[model samples]
Target: MLGIKEIEAIIPHRHPFLLIDCVEELEPGVRAVGYKCVTFHEDFFRGHFPQEPVMPGVLIIEALAQVGAVSILSVEENKGKVAYFGGINSAKFRRKVVPGDRLRLECEIIKQKGPVGIGRATATVDGKVAVTAELTFMIG
Candidate 1:
């Protein structure tokens, strides 16, 4: 498992923006599984909806992307490089993610050609899927 510090060493995300909490599984340039412990303390909860805060779908997608980043960036040749979103396709949000939920994120590189690739990603809460997407990334 890789903690926040170890994740930081591989990617460029910082506090607040760094959505993933820890990586439970990883295969450099192949796939990764990570988690995000959502809480009421999240800054976005303040303005997203005061009465009933919900983790934004975009942020959920970003969290999944971060997991994909870790998978690709962990490759020796890709070390220190940043993975930028080339595109997000077929994203579907099935359930609302709220505070206290432990978000499980998984991403597998489905295809790659040079620095560009596609990943199959998903985010789940408990045992149910919260979101799923096909992400395209460019290593820079």
Candidate 2:
């Protein structure tokens, strides 16, 4: 398991923008499983819907991408590198994520060619899928 500080070492995101809280499982370049503990204090919730406070779908995808980044960027050759979004495909949102939800993010590298790769990513809350996407990333 990786704490916030360890995750910060692997990725350049910081508070407010760093969507993932910690990584629970990692396989270097192969896969990663992470979590995000949503709370009413999240900045996005202030404007996303002051009344309902649903977590934005895009942020959920970003969190999943961060988990994917942790997996790919942990490899020795890729350490200190950054992963940029090359594309997002087949994305689907099945449920609304809100405050108090513990989001589980999973990503597996499905294809790779040099510094570019595709990951199959998913975000779930309480074992129910909230979003899934095929993310293309370019390492730099």
Across 1-140, the per-residue lDDT of candidate 2 in tens digits comes to 99999999999999889999999999999999999999999999889999899999999999999999999999999999999999999999999999999999999999999999999999999899999999999999
Q: Against the true structure, candidate 1 has what lDDT?
A: 0.98
TM-score of each: 0.99, 0.99
- The residue pairs in collision within model 2 are none
lDDT (tens digit, per residue) of candidate 1 on 63-100:
99999999999999999999999999999999999999
Clashing pairs in 1: none
Cα RMSD (Å) between model 1 and the true structure?
A: 0.5
Model 1 TM-score (2 dp)? 0.99
Predictions in order: lDDT: 0.98, 0.97
Cα distance off (Å), candidate 1, residue 2: 0.3
